[model samples]
Target: MSKTRQHCFDFGVPPALTLLLGLWGITRNNSMWRDEAATWEAAHRTIPEIWSLLGRIDMVHGLYYLFMHGVFTVFGDRLYCLRLPSLLAMACATALLTLLGSRLVDASTGLATGLAFALLPAVQQYAQEGRPYALVTACEVLACWLLVTAVDASNWCHWAAYGTTVLVAALLNWFSLLILFAHAATIALARTPRAVIARWALSASCAVLGSLPLVMASQAQSGQVSWIPPVGLGTTLNLLMTVVMGALGAYLARTRLASGSVRVSLSALALPLLALPPLLLLAVSLTRPLYQTRYVLFSQIGLALLIGAACHALASRFRRQPRRSIVLAAAVALVALLPIEVPLRSAGSRVDDVLSTADNVAAVRKPGDAVLYIPAARRDTALVSPGAFTGTRDLALIENPRQSNTLQGVEGTPEYIRKAMLTARRIIVVTDDNTSPPASARDRTKEQVLRSHFIRRYETRERGRKIVVYVRRADDRAATPTSRCPCFVRKGSTPTPPGVVPTEQSKSNRTQ
Candidate 1:
C-alpha cells in the first residue's frame, strides 16, 4: 500500500468499528433516563428559554444545550438525534487516539489503542448517551494530539490550535481542564527542550484564561452535583487498581522501546493521562465531594494507550509468531467484553426507564386526575413524554417548565400544594424508588399530605420508577379498604360510574 493508503487503513478501521458498536441498539429501547431527559427537555426549548434557564441553573451545560438546540432545530426531536452527536463524538475521539498512538509508538500499537478504546464499557455507555461527556472526551483527545504535535514542532500555529481545542473542551465541561495537568506532566517527564516547554506554558495559560469565566460561572451551579457521594474505600480501591494497571503497562512499554524510536514516549504520555485527572478529582473530593467517573471519561483514552503499549510489548515476545499472538489477544479481549457490551444496549441498564413510566401513566390515567411529582424532579417523566400527561393536571405546578425556565416547573408553596391536593378526588403520584427522606420541606409536605388524607388504590413499579393511584379517604368510613374506591379499578377494566362505589368483594371477584 502507498504511504497515504497505509495511514488511512491504520486510522480508519478502529473508528469504523467504534461507530458500528455505538450504533448497535443506539435507542436503548426508546428509553430516555432522567439525565438524558434533562438534555431532551433543554434541547427542545427555544434559545431564549435556554438562555433564561442558564442564568438560574445548568450554566455549566449552557454551550452544550445551545449546540443541541441547534441540532434539534435542524433534525427535529427524536431519540436518535438526541444521542447521535455523542456517538459521532466518541468515534472522533477514537480516531484521534489512533493517530496519537501512531505518533507516540507504532502503527500497530496505534491500531490496538483505538480498538481498545472502542471496547471500553464506559466509552460504550457514554457514546450512546445524550450528554456532553462524550463531546468533552473528543475535544480532550484532539487537544492532546495537537499538544503532542506542537511540542514536537514548536510551531505557533500548532500551539494556537491546541489552545483553541482546550478552550472548547473546557467550555463543554470544566472538569476537562484537568487534562492540562496530565499534558504538563507528559512534557515534564519527557525532559522536553525549554523552548517547547515555554510554548506549552503560553498555550496552556491562554486556554485557562479563556476558560476562567466558565469556571467561575459553573461554581454557582456547583450544587447540582451535591448528590455525588463522598470518596469511600471502594472508590479508593478502584483508583488504586487503575493506577497499578497503568504503571504495569508503562513499565512493560519502557522495557520494550529504545530511545529516539518515537517522538513522544508512550509511558510519559499514557501514564499521566490515565492517572492524574481522576486522582486529583478524588483528592479534592476528600474535602468536598466532586468526583464522578463520567467527569473524567477522557481518562479512558490514556488507559487505551497503555493497553496498546502493553499488548505491543507482549506480542514482541512471540517473535516467531507475532501475528498469531496478536490475533489470539484480540480474540480474548472480544470474548471478555462481549457480556458487558450486550447489557449496555438494554433499557434495564439505565437507572430508570422514562418511557416505560410514561406509558404506564398514560394507560391508567383518567380525566381530571391530578398528577403530583414527588421531589418535583420526577416531573421530567411528564416533560419528556408530554402526550402521556395531556388530560391530567399538574396540581403543584405554579408555572410550566418553559414559563419558569427550569427543567422542572416551579412548584406552588407547601400550603398551596396541600390545598390543591385536598381539592382532588383522585391523584396520580410519580416518584422514584429511593427510600431516602424528601430533600426539601416542600417535598416533605407532599408526602405528609398524601399519607394523611389519600389512600393508594393501585401501584406499580417498573425499572426503578413508582407510579401510584390514590383516592381521597372517605371521611365517614375511614376504615374502608381501597379496593372499594372508584379509582381502584384494575387496568383495562370498566371504571365504576361516578358517585357509585363497588363493594370490596365485587371488585375482588371482577379482578379474579
Candidate 2:
C-alpha cells in the first residue's frame, strides 16, 4: 500500500475493531457488583438527593452518577442501558489512544497501540462496568491528545479545550488528576518551547482551579476508601513489575527514524503515566490508606500504547517480507490475548457474581423465612429484584433503600435485629466469603442468635459470597410469630401488600 493509504488504514481500522471487541459481551447480564449497585442506588435518586449524597460521600463520583441519571432516565434500568455509556466511552478512548500514539510516534504504531488496548484484560473489564472508570480513561486520553496539539500549536483555543477536558476528567474521578503530573514530565522531557510551556501551565492551572471544590469535598469524605490496605512488600513488587515491563515495551517500540522529540516524549510519558500514580498513591497510603488498582486504571493506556508500538517495530523489522510477517504477528497476539478475554465475557467473572447469588437465594428461600445481610452491604444481592424476596422479610432492615436514599438501606440496632430475628421460623444469612468468621458486631450477633435458637439447615458458598439457612428449633415457642416485617413498606404507608408477606399458600409452595 502507498504511504497515504497506509496512514488512512491505520486511522480507521483500529477504532472499528475496538468497537466490535467492546460490544461483543457488553450486555452479559452479570449481576451488578457492589459498586455498580451503589451507582444504581445513587443514580435512581432525585437530583437533590444525589447532591446531598455527595456532601457526605462519593463526591468524586457525583458527576458520573448525574450522567448515569440522564442515561437511566431515557433508557430505563436495563443492564445493557446502564453499561452502554462505558462501552461507547471505551471505544472513544481506544480511538483517542490511536490519535495520541500517532502524534507521539507514527500512524502504524498508533494502530498497533489501539489494538493492544482493546485486548487488555483491564480495559475489557472496565469497558463493561456501569461505573465511571471507563469514562475517566476516555477523558484522560482525550485530554492528552489535546495537550499534545495545544503544545505543538501553542494556541489558546487548543489549550482551552485541553484544560476543559482535564477538569471534566478530574470531576469524573479525582484520581484522574494525577495525569497532569505525568503530562508535566512530557513537557519537561521534550524541552517544549517557552510559549508552549506557558500555555500548558495555564491549561493545567485552569483544570486544577476548576476542579478544586470537588477535590476538597472528596478529601473530607476520604474515609469511604478506608477499606484499602496500607502498602506493603507484595504490592510494591507488583507495581515495580508493571512499571518495568511497560517501560521496556515502550523502549522496544522506538524506531531509528522517529523524531527525537517524539521518542523522548513517549519515553517520559509511558513510564510516569504507568508508574507515578501507583507510587504516589503508595506513598500517600503510608499515611492514609488510599491505594487501589482500579483508581489507577488509566495507567494501562500508557502501557498498551507502548506495547502496541513495540508490535509495530517488530513487524517493521521484516520490511522485506512485510505482509506475511505482520499477519503472523497479529495472529500470535490474538492467540495470546484469548485466555484473558474468555472469562471477562462471562457472568461468573465478577468478584460478587450477584446473579448467581440471587439464583441461589431464590432456590433455597422458603415463605415465612427472613433474610439478613451480615455486613449490610451484601443487600446488593437483593437490589436488582426487590420482588425476588417477596413473601419474606429482611429482618434487620430499617428503611427501604430507595425510600431512604441510601446505598443498601439502613440496618436496625443489634438489639432490634435480635428481636426481629426471633419472629421468623427460618432465616437466610448472606455473608462475604472473603471475610472470616465474626465479620462485624451485627454478623456476630446474627450468628450467636441463630446458633443458640436454631439449627443450621444448609449452606452454599460462591466466589465472593456465602449463604446459609437456619431453621427454628421445633420446641421453641417463646418468640413472637409475626408473618411479615413492617420495614419494607414506604414511609407513612399503612397496610402491607399480600403476596409480599408470608402466607399459608407461600409456605405450601416451599414445603412441596
What TM-score goes with each of the models? 0.92, 0.87
In candidate 1, list every pair of residues with a backbone clash. Answer: none
Model 1: ten consecutive residues of lowest lDDT: 503-512
CA deviation > 4 Å runs, candidate 1 = 1-6, 259-262, 319-324, 475-512
Model 2, position 390, has a per-residue lDDT of 63
lDDT of 1 by residue, 1-512 (tens): 68788678778977997899999999887677899889988988889999999987899888999999999899877788999999999999999999888888778778778888888899999999999999999999999889878878889999999999999998999899999999999999878999989989999999999999988987888889998899899988998898899888878777754443655687788889899999999999999999989999999988999887788778877665443465467668878999998999988899897877777777667878899998799998887777777668999999988888889989999999999999998898999867888998788888898888987777667777888877888742554555664443233333444443423221110100
On lDDT, the candidate that comes out on top is 1
Cα displacement (Å) at residue 144, model 2: 0.9
Local accuracy of candidate 2 as per-residue lDDT tens digits, 1-512? 89888766777766776677778787654456778778877887888989877776678899999999999898787778778899899889988898887778776677777777877788888988999999999998898788777777777999999999989989998888888888888888777887788888989999999999988878887778877778888988988998888877866765522453443456666677888777888888889888877788898888887777777778778685443454466567767988888778776577775655665666566667799988888897677555456667899999877556566777888899889888988888887876567756877888889877876655667657777766687644543223321223122222233222322222221100
| Best candidate (score: TM-score) | 1
